[model samples]
Target: MTSVAVKARVTGRVQGVAFRTWARAEAVRHGLSGWIRNEPDGSVRALLMGPAASVADMVRRMGRGPGAASVKDVLTERTDPEPGVSGFRIVG
Candidate 1:
């Protein structure tokens, strides 16, 4: 399994809908390590790190966040994984 990292920016109705919390839970469930945070521009940004397949799955799931969220778009890009980061969390 190839480990990979992905950076994603999720837009539209993502903030104030428990998106970060939900993402943390999802990442943990998938054994991913990274962080999710709310951007000042009202978008949610996340770094997903794990096996390529798991990260891909997480990205797909992020496209449709919690029921309260109305995700308009999910933009993703491959990136270097964070060093020494373990477990998922909500960060500023």
Candidate 2:
């Protein structure tokens, strides 16, 4: 599988809803590596790295975060994976 990376900004009821935790778990499940954080704009930003398909799947999952989260949209961009990055985490 070809490794790839993606940067995503998820908007709408994403903050204060365990979205970051959910995203971390999801990324790990897909064997992705990167970080996620809460944005000042009430959105959640994440950088995911993994197999191309897994990264894409992670982006799709961002559209439907934790049950309490009402994800309205997810803006994603293709990017280079962080060098030597391993494991997904929540960045403070």
Candidate 3:
């Protein structure tokens, strides 16, 4: 199976809404490896690398994040996979 690495920027009521935690859990559930963090601009950013189907599923979930997060938009793009990410995590 082919895999892909993607960078996603989630906007709107995302920050301070447990978005990171939700994202991490979701990513792990989908067997993805990546890091999720809050951006200084009040958006949530994530780098996901895993099976193409899983990554795409994760992106879709991000759009409806945690219920508490009113996701307005999501920006996704391809990227080179990073090394050494054991699982999904919320980065500071």
Candidate 4:
């Protein structure tokens, strides 16, 4: 099966809510490989790569985020994976 990668930007009360940690854990649970981090503009940016269905699910979860996160917008777009990317990371 072909895997898919997507760039996701979650906005609204996302910062300071452990969003990255939550995403990293969820990605691992979903058997996904990618990364997540806090954006300077008060958003959470993430990449979810795995089966198309899994990636889609990840995006949906981003919309909901953790209970503490007030997700206002979950914007996503198809993207290419970085060379040799593996595992979910919470980057600076």
Every model's TM-score: 0.98, 0.95, 0.96, 0.96
Q: Highest lDDT: which candidate?
A: 1
lDDT per residue as tens, model 3, 1-92: 89999999999999888999889888888999989999999998999999999999999999999978899999999999998877888896
* Better structure of 3 and 4 per TM-score: 3
- Candidate 1's error at 20, in angstroms? 0.5
For every model shown, the clashing-pair count is 0, 0, 0, 0
* Tens digit per residue, CA lDDT, model 2, 1-92: 89888889999999888899988988888888999998898988999888899988888888888999999999998898788777888986
Off by over 4 Å in 1: none
Q: Which ranges of candidate 4 are over 4 A from the true structure?
A: none
Worst 10 residues of 3 by lDDT: 83-92
Instruction: List per-prediction Cα lDDT, in the order shown.
Output: 0.95, 0.89, 0.92, 0.90
lDDT-sorted candidate list, best first: 1, 3, 4, 2
Q: For model 4, how does the per-residue alpha-carbon lDDT over 1-92 read when each residue is reduced to its tens digit?
A: 67998999999999998888888999999999988988899988888899999898889888899988899999998998877889999986
Best by TM-score: 1
